[model samples]
Target chain A: MIPLDETDKNILNAIQFDFPLDVKPFEKLGEQLEIKEEELLRRIQRLNAAGAIRRIGPIINTKKLGGVSTLAAVSVPEANIDKVAEYINQYPEVSHNYLRPDKYNIWFTVSADDENRLNEILEDIEKETDCPLINLPTVRLFKIGVMFNIR
Target chain B: MKDIYIQLLRITQDGIPFTSRPFKDAAAELNISEEEVVDLIRKMQSEGIIRRFGASIGHRVLGITANAMCTWNVPDERVEEVGKIMAGFSEVTHCYERPRYPDWPYNLFTMVHSYTEEDCIRTAEDISKATGIEDYKLLFSEKEFKKTGIRI
Candidate 1:
């Protein structure tokens, strides 16, 4: 892992939320960090290449965009986990899939444009995987955001 | 909302181009002024349709290898109180109240991130101690099957 300095940490923290939207957003960001615009851009590029910055962009609210989503879990035998996960992952709606340590070993969040599309994907997965799945849709979204202090 | 605004969203769903004049590039493609694109984005933020404009990081690549979906079986009467407490923690990134199922009694879910598995477990224990809710379980991700932002 690349060791992050104070400047890098500050940059990461600032860019995580409310990144400037000006013609020269990086320049504005550099002003906040007390660094040169060129240097800031270079560091951001390096960070992106290093896989630290997954993507630099606007995070659209899926629900606001008329998408129906739910958290679902399934249990696959140990031997068929990879194959089953691969099959489930083929659906574009099935995002944030993970293998958890529990009876419901495979958990994932799926999102689709509408209720019909969402159910179609779920039904397809259940039939293909031949595993009973549980759907745990969020009744109330109290909070949804992730920000880590690099410092 | 105008058709132009929807077009802009389509252009930006993946991300803003990584360039100095990113908005300008977007405007050029849509045959609109850069100022208009910025104005629309600003308007969207004010409307709460866009939560925040920012960069997403690979937390695992940054040494945050452990994550747990900590579920709490808080009573219906106290779910709101306990949920607010859980949501207050910096380590608790996503917190929600979901419907309980048969043989699955957890009603509250909180996603916690830590540098190690021990740290994650400790966070879960600390949450329980703070909330005074004994019925809880920590589900750690043994493997990441897939992860992608919701596409509109």
Candidate 2:
């Protein structure tokens, strides 16, 4: 594990949810974190290089951004899981595909520009995989906050 | 989203650069003032189009290795209540209520991230006991083929 000092932990905690929307946001945030803007930037760069920070940017609401996404699950035979997952990965719309130990093991997300596009992509994937896929669209988002308490 | 904002989203999808004058780059690319770019960001945030604007963390990098999708078959009446209860836990990162398939009765889905599988089991059990929901299964991700999140 990449060792994170107190300042690094504080920086992650401070900026995970909101980066100030201002002309000089790092300056304002640095003031709150009691660190110089340059030092904070240096630390941010280090953390980012270490793969601690995946990206420093906006997490757009895909659905609100005029697109649709659904969490889909399909049970592929053990031998076909790899081939099916590799096939599904060809689509840029798919994300977070995982193999879990269950009947419906292959779980993925199919996000598209619209409902029609989403359905078409799913149908094409199902036709290739030859496994019935269940689309579980989120009816209500209770919480999506992903603030990690870096200790 | 307005045409102007769509332009902004495409430009800023990689996120604002890490610099003193961060928005200037995006603003200059879009041929707008930095102040205007910030204003559009604020507007989109208020409109709920920009869910969040900050660091996207890699939990595993933070020593959070084990993660599982714990799906609960919450009763229709208790979905909202159980959802809140489940989401209140700091360990639970994502909690959502989705449709219950005929063969699969799990409706309330939660993502639990922890340090180990034992921690996940303990936390899931604690959650089940707290909510009094018996029918649930913990689906641990054996291998993550893709997790780079959606791009513009």
Cα-based RMSD of the predictions, in order? 2.0, 1.6
lDDT of 1 by residue, B45-147 (tens): 7877777778888787789888899988999999989999999888898999988878688999999998988999999989999999999999998888788
Q: Give per-residue CA lDDT, model 2, range A25-87, as digits (tens).
A: 999999999999999999998888888887777778888777899999998999999999998
Prediction 1 TM-score vs. true = 0.92
lDDT to native, each model? 0.84, 0.88
Best by DockQ: 2
User: Would you list the clashing residue pairs of candidate 2?
Assistant: none
lDDT of 2: 0.88
Calculate DockQ per candidate and list them.
0.70, 0.78
TM-scores, chain A, per candidate: 0.88, 0.90
Positional deviation of A72 in candidate 2, in angstroms? 0.8
Instruction: For candidate 2, give the lDDT of residue B134.
Output: 94
